[model samples]
Target: MGLAKVSSFLLVILFLINGGSSTTFTIVNQCNYTVWPGLLSGAGTAPLPTTGFQLSSSESRLISIPAAWSGRIWGRTLCNQNETTGRFTCVTGDCASSQIECSGAGAIPPATLAEFTLNGAENLDFYDVSLVDGYNLPMTIVPNGGANGVGKCNTAGCAADLNGVCPEQLKVTVEAAGTTGVACKSACEAFGTPEFCCSGAFGTPDTCKPSEYAVFFKNACPTAYSYAYDDGTSTFTCSGADYVITFCPSVSSI
Candidate 1:
């Protein structure tokens, strides 16, 4: 066979062997305490090998995400599994299923979310660290190991402890003693008003401009999504790059 034909044959074999395309995500836990990482695949998407797992402090794990997959990931803290029932529960980022797998359930509001839509048109990946639900853990997403195409591929997330400064009304307090202010809830989740939730008449970008609560989040994590419609500046794009999602990349008070 000619040289060009030989190269094409090799490419075909590689593709078949690998079952097409995918990306690697290195999930890291840098907090002082352990965190349970939870994964939830988007509607009509195939799930990963494990939906939830334990990550001791400063631990890391690699996850393979298939091409065109969309999903959301978050960290759950202070979790315990019932020995008798085998049901699991967490103080933060709890899904209704009450099991480790999450099994098609998404995280409840007030939990920091790392959202991703991979291998979209032009082979680009779209991702963001979103606080629209609220804030529980500090997280960051960095593109690595590829020619990440243009347009703000810079790392994005909340690295600060928004909980420390969270307004009283938005603070999520656990009934168990010594677990107060563990998470900071969004105004939308706390108030459930049309203006805060961006629903009803306040559904449009023009209508739902940033309120004082959103401003607080935006000030702390400038690159992260502060509210439901914080799209233009918060969304990030990259092409053919592996990602590192680090929870609590740096220690912060409160």
Candidate 2:
């Protein structure tokens, strides 16, 4: 109503439009080999400058994400680019685009996912390291600064080498090099049964108990999604903090 009040109201409106504060994601490639990190914004969310970029062993990249943004990130491995088409293809976590820039396409399943919904109600950010899709590379999401004021904002991920113990049924292998497994598949992908996928008769949490396969993943990564109904403990929330996403972080780090 008053001129000063009107000015304050306009500022508040501008803040929402511009996103009150930005969060930086420092993606680190700690793997022994090179990896191309892929990023995809959720539907209707603002896109980042580069969808995919190369990261050699021990290299890192810092990306500033706008407030209220939501998206998923993953690492692409064993990649090769076609000089003519300028398209990139990877052994794991390759999106449909088959290029350096994923555009709006998400990674093909059986790839580890670092999912985030930042700056929501009460200035909290909800994030998780999910193997629900499956595990290609080990990943950890660490919150920095005063993000731990609340309870349980701990690091999350599957830091172990799951592929070594991946059951034969759940092993995904590249065609050209079919001897060794490249990624571990979720029970849902390995077998589309209702019980494994939590679909049809097993759609509800009460109906679908964790299977032995899911349990294997759960044991390896207690903080990550082992199956479709892993929300209870898999999802984590933090406030006013940036993030460090590392591929192949030490097991003790989480």
Candidate 3:
């Protein structure tokens, strides 16, 4: 196609050359089920969805295209469904197909990897592919065993995996992967412990915003700290392995 400009929601700087570079996009799966093909996003006056790529468990696949692509990419992991059967689903059982169906017999029905943003113009970044079973599922990206990524926005946010750390990349992955090295729940509620920590004994529930915690992480350690999450069922605690012993407002954020 012609010059494919990066979307505005993301931060990128595109350079045009005689023959653009050919970079392979990789998708990794650390979750249970397989993910569908894949989709790409663009703004040729509107956002258009592209086809997807299929990957198996712990599988990695790459896609190479001529046009410069960045920003939000879309797609789903569907089963091998039957189109001729009125309402066809890509999958039903274990049988696998791009958008086809199987005979109620197969390995395992594929799951969906929600749409994620892929911007190459910023610091090089890749997505940590994790198949999800449903909508309410928690993230398998951060503090989990998966890949790392960066936001296309200026808003502050860090990513980690089940490994409890973020990629050491310059851009997408940054210096704030684990601010205090001791990371805690953004919302105790998100961790199903908000009422207790933000509102429980010894703790002042819901009194601290993530930005506040961020300030503490930056000021308390400023350099870097050890990160750990103490998840006790209905109670959650995130702190620096060697630092967090008290809660105080970071003078900066304040």
Compare the candidates by lDDT and give the number of the best one.
2
| Tens-place lDDT digits, model 2, residues 90-180 | 8889996877788888999889999999876676788999998889989999988745575357787879888778889898887786668
Estimate TM-scores for all models: 0.91, 0.91, 0.31
For all candidates in order, the CA lDDT equals: 0.87, 0.88, 0.28
State the weakest 10-residue window (summed lDDT) of model 2.
145-154
Q: Which stretches of candidate 3 lie over 4 Å from their true place?
A: 1-19, 45-50, 65-67, 71-78, 86-254
Worst 10 residues of 1 by lDDT: 145-154
Per-residue lDDT tens digits for candidate 3, residues 1-254, read 23444352222323333224433334444335555433434443223223444555566554553333433221233344455765434321222333332222222312212222232334332232222111111122111111233332111111122112312210121154433221122222223344323334324323523333333333332222111121111111111111111011122321
Task: Write one digit per residue (lDDT tens) for candidate 1, span 1-254.
Answer: 99999999999999955547788999999999999999999988877988888999989999998877899999998889999998899889988677877877888777999999987666678999999999998999998865634545778888998777898889888778455589999999899999999998999999999989999999999989999899988998987788999999863321
lDDT of 3 at 136: 12
Candidate 2 error regions (>4 Å) = 1-18, 175-178
Q: Runs in model 1 with CA error above 4 Å?
A: 2-19, 177-179, 251-254
